[model samples]
Target: MIVEHAVLRVRPGQAAAFETAMAKARPLVTVQQGFLSIEVRPSCDDPEIYLLLIGWDRIESHRDGFRQSPDYPHWRALLHHFYDPMPVVNYYGRSIFHD
Candidate 1:
């Protein structure tokens, strides 16, 4: 399996709204193929920082699948505005502990 990691830095005072929007957007992703799970955690030290982790069957499942699907535009519209400089996404696979 592959894990998608992204650190989202939301605009000041918009954390609540961002979370709410994320809730609405979650369904769009859940319906996609190869989707295992999605998780978002808020930083303890800074409310604006969010840790996003998504489980996929493979890297292309996200990069070439969901991101290419019609729902992607909707997902982007609902949540992209909240980011200031935007977030960088990275992928990890086959953890050593489990391997």
Candidate 2:
């Protein structure tokens, strides 16, 4: 599986709205081809920071497939405006693990 990580730094006081929008956006990604799962978690250390973990069967599904789909625009519209400096998104494949 490939994991896409987006370290979202939402503006202060915007966490609740960001989370609410993501709740609605999550299902859109779930229905896409090669989607495995989606997870969103708030940072304990920094309340304005949120971590998004998305599982995909292949890298292209995230980079090419999802971006090409119509749902992406909707997803962007719902969640893109909350970013403080905008999130940094990157994908990873399993490489090392302790457990």
Best by TM-score: 1
Off by over 4 Å in 1: none
Give a tens-digit lDDT track for model 2, residues 5-97.
999999889999988999899888999999998888889999999899999999999889998999999999999999979878899998698
Write model 1 residue lDDT over 31-67, tens digit each, in one string. Answer: 9899999999999999999999999999999999999
Residue 90 in model 1: shift from native, Å?
A: 0.2
Q: What is the lDDT of residue 64 in candidate 2?
A: 91
lDDT against the true structure, each candidate: 0.97, 0.91
Off by over 4 Å in 2: none
Q: Give the Cα error of residue 44 in candidate 2, in Å.
A: 0.6
TM-score of 1: 0.97
RMSD of 2: 1.4
Task: Please give the lDDT score for candidate 1.
Answer: 0.97
lDDT at 35 for candidate 2? 96
